[model samples]
Target: MSRPVVGYAPGAYDMFHIGHLRVLERARSECDLLIAGVATDAVVLSAKAKHPVIPFEQRLEIVSSIRYVDQAIADPHVDKYLTWQRIGFHVLFKGDDWRGTERAHEMESKLESVGVGIVYFPYTGDVSTTLLRTRLSVSE
Candidate 1:
């Protein structure tokens, strides 16, 4: 606890909405430095079975520009512990949506073994990129 806190929040920031901003801001508030990981287009497609509306570079740039983010990286992997090992984050931040799932349970187990902190922010499911995409596609 004496060491400076480094926070990480990884996501597929497709449309970069206020919800993303809220999480990043909240993460920033809890740590000395905050790193935002933008999921790569290939990773997103492989994992989600759909390409993001905004390209990877654009999404990375957008996340980097946010005031709350100290650094941004393109994440090609889904393993949160691997990311933690690579970045040496003191705390792992995620949306509350993953709070009770198997993935969350797995991550909590891994982080707990290493004494790493895990925090989940309020999920803003109503203001997600999926909803935005659905609304846009209908209009078009």
Candidate 2:
């Protein structure tokens, strides 16, 4: 039997929007199964130094409800390779915005070392949770 193509995409899906939906949908199209990793509140705070406007539970619930995401997992770490170790996904999907950065290049090497391909999707224009939060703050 042919092996199923599994894909893993990780992010903090706070204040869900089309950008998030686009990535998940695009990721799903490339694999037989798509695993969306919802970053935990602590993980978000640690990595981004800001708490999510939507709580982790709500974020997971929103991500779970997305039709494109086959499954959702609570992501406790930022190490993509480690997530791949546990999930055994064949492809790792990341936003094209992260492409060409030093850290991204390093991450690509790590995933490649384990024979996992890295695919970068074009970042949606004009919308993101961070921008949403900033707009909300400005309006207030």
Candidate 3:
């Protein structure tokens, strides 16, 4: 029999929102198992230059509780290849926002070389943690 399709969806997932849920749900639908990688505070700080509004532990807990996520773990690496080496997922799920970027292209090349595929879900443009933070700051 063919191996099960395992998908990895990595994100900071700060300030959990419906958009995040939708991505995870859609990712789960496409794969037999969905692993949500919750970026740690240090990883978020290094990647986005800002710490998450929610604590890493809390964010992890929230993601772990999601019905669509079969597993949740701290994603400490900035390099997707490293995560793949560790997790060995058959596919990677990401927002379409990264679809055409340089980083995404690099990632696509690397992942494809290793027999892994990437699936980009439609980006939820209406809301995001960055927008929420900006709104909060403006109101404050």
Candidate 4:
């Protein structure tokens, strides 16, 4: 039997939005299973100035509850290659906004060496957690 294709996406996943769902749907289409990496509190703080409104454990539970997600894991590190090595996923799914960029180029070089392909999906314009947060902040 052939090994099932799996795609991995890592993020803070705070207050999941349409954009996050789009990525999950696209990733599911490209692979049999989708595993999301919810960044831990420490990792989120290190990566961004603002901490997630929803805590890491809640974020993990929320992401895991999504129908499109097969599994959810905590991402202690933001390195895509390191996550891939740890999970052994077949493909890494991310937004096309990162494609052809320096970071994407570096990730491709590293993952390709391990036989893991990278699939960059088209970003859902004007619909992201950041935008949602801004809207909510103004409404309050």
Q: How badly does each model clash, as a count of residue pairs?
A: 0, 0, 0, 0
State, as a TM-score between 0 and 1, how close model 1 is to the true structure: 0.93
What are the lDDT figures for the candidates, one per model?
0.90, 0.92, 0.95, 0.86
In candidate 3, position 62 carries an lDDT of: 97
lDDT tens string, model 2, 1-140? 99999999999999999999999999999999999999999999997899988999999999999999999999997778888888899998988989998879888999999999999999986998888998999999
Q: What is the C-alpha RMSD of each candidate to the true structure, in Å?
A: 1.5, 0.9, 0.7, 1.5
Point out where model 4 deviates above 4 Å. none
Which window of ten consecutive residues has the lowest lDDT sum in model 4? 77-86
Residues 85-116 of candidate 1: C-alpha lDDT, one tens digit per residue? 88888898999988999978998999878888
Candidate 4 residues 1-140, lDDT tens each?
A: 99898889877888888888888887888899899999999888886778889998899999999998999999998678888878899888888878888867988999999999888888887887778889999999
The ten-residue window of minimal lDDT in model 3 covers 97-106
Q: Which stretches of candidate 1 lie above 4 Å from their native place? A: none
Q: Using TM-score as the measure, which candidate wins?
A: 3
Order the candidates by lDDT, highest first — what do you get? 3, 2, 1, 4
**Per-residue lDDT of 128 in model 3:** 89
Error at 119, model 2, angstroms: 0.7
**Candidate 1 total steric clashes:** 0
Alpha-carbon deviation at 134 in model 4, angstroms: 2.0
Global Cα lDDT for candidate 1: 0.90
Error of 2 at 101 (Å): 1.9
TM-score for candidate 2, residues paired by index: 0.96
